[model samples]
Target: MTTQYAKPLPRVHDLNRAFFLGALDGRLVLQHCDACGHVWFPSAQSCPKCLSQEITWKPVSGRGRVWSWVVMHQRYIPAFADDLPYAVAFVELEEGPFMMTSIVGAEPEDLVCDMPVEVAFDQVTDEVALPKFRPVTGEAS
Candidate 1:
């Protein structure tokens, strides 16, 4: 039985294919050290702490708050021309990790520190779909 899902993202940065596939499955995957409990994003080969090679993948809640942000008046890529005036933000996940992505579903004037945000996925191309953040319902602040 197949459920509708995101297509696979293109290979980049020599990272593990499983990591990308996990995101396509609508679950956030990150590496955690079995020895020291250290977690790594972008899926490293092993844990950065304690030099442990015993790392495993785990799903995390995609909830976070807006830690910082910037309003981009110009598109660095032509593909993003239509998305001009977007807010690029760094969200510090409640799980204790920081992710850099665009903030959606809210106006620039409404974005502020510690604003409640939730993850939303967007298929930017046939190969890659990104996880972005949007303001949580009724939490406009």
Candidate 2:
């Protein structure tokens, strides 16, 4: 098997450590506000809705729909040069948060807005697993 090198790894700090750690065990987590029951991504110190500092890391169903997508024909970063013509997408999670991720397991031309998709984890390194999306098959959207 050929080993692939990951382009970049997220810096784990106290604020967003839970997110990266959750990926270690194949779980997709988001920041949830205990005060207003609001959940969001790209973790923050307080709830965006209620401005509550009581945030919790909660697991979410790894299912969503493709909100939008773009095909990268040119390599903007040297590390991504080998993987040209890939699709990067915004997936609207079932819990109401949109996550930026790469859509895999299907051709770029096959991706459509509002397509049902589910999360798939790719272990780029021993310490990190990136959550990606793939089209749902045999299931009604």
Candidate 3:
């Protein structure tokens, strides 16, 4: 049989030292272009549209809607054994940035497109905390 539980790749960036430090502190930092009012994720130095170096970092409301999702039934690594079946989804943040993150605090059977979600943090490593999502509390009808 093929290796259904191979190890996942190590993170490319030191999230804890860089991004997670701010996120853990309850600050959501995204790159904002002063020229076009556009925001960039993964923290780009320049605007993707205008390529302007004139950028600023700002905090955003960590609320979004589930734009899309997929459930992985097969395990890719031993570390993921317990989480054999999990939902990976694209969360469209209110600030106009779409991020790929795991959907938590809810079951896959209940997940749907356009379901409101709010941000929660997961500390994978000492310095690497990820921004995950949960169902928005007191969601409007």
Candidate 4:
């Protein structure tokens, strides 16, 4: 179901469709290599470590920590002009893969390294849900 989504949309393909689909369902899915027992993001045709085509798209904990981030004061894209000074962060998931997204629950200035975060989806389109992160509060940091 397409809507009046203003921003750019991902090119849905065989390699990455599972990821987009899982996000739509409010779940985090990654590629699990049966041969090497490794999990990864940005899905691929085969395992990067073992080069085995035995891969499966499985759910993950959707929890991570902010490894690094940058607050963008410049408007690089016109659609993102309203989002200027937004925080773009790199999160290291508990499963080991790193995902680049924005943390929603905290202000950019308050962000710190190794901040606890969990996945939150922003449904920009009817078929695509952008995976984002948010601070996990009420827990020991």
| TM match of model 3 to true structure | 0.84
Model 1 steric clash total: 0
> Please, what is the TM-score per model?
0.82, 0.93, 0.84, 0.96
Give the per-residue lDDT digits (tens) of candidate 4, residues 1-141: 657888777899989999999999999999999998999978899998899999999999999999999999998888889977899999999999999898897989989998899999999888899999999997666
Native-referenced Cα lDDT, model 3: 0.78
Better of 1 and 3 by lDDT: 3
Model 1 lDDT tens row, 36-106 = 98876657777776888888888888888999999888867676677678888999887778888888888
Model 2: colliding residue pairs: none
1-141: candidate 3 lDDT, tens digit per residue: 233333353364532234556676766677789998888677666798799988877788988999999998997766877886899999999989999998889998889888999888865555455688999868861
Model 2 misplaced stretches (Cα beyond 4 Å) = 1-6
Best by TM-score: 4
Better of 3 and 4 by lDDT: 4
Choose the strongest candidate by lDDT. Answer: 4
Flag regions of model 1 displaced more than 4 Å.
1-10, 139-141
Identify the runs in model 4 with alpha carbons over 4 angstroms from their true place: 1-3
Q: Residue 126 deviation, candidate 1, in Å? A: 4.8
Q: Indicate whether candidate 2 or candidate 3 has the larger TM-score.
A: 2
- lDDT, candidate 4, residue 62? 100
In candidate 4, position 67 carries an lDDT of 97
Model 3 misses residue 138 by how many Å?
Answer: 2.7
The candidate with the higher lDDT, 1 or 2, is 2
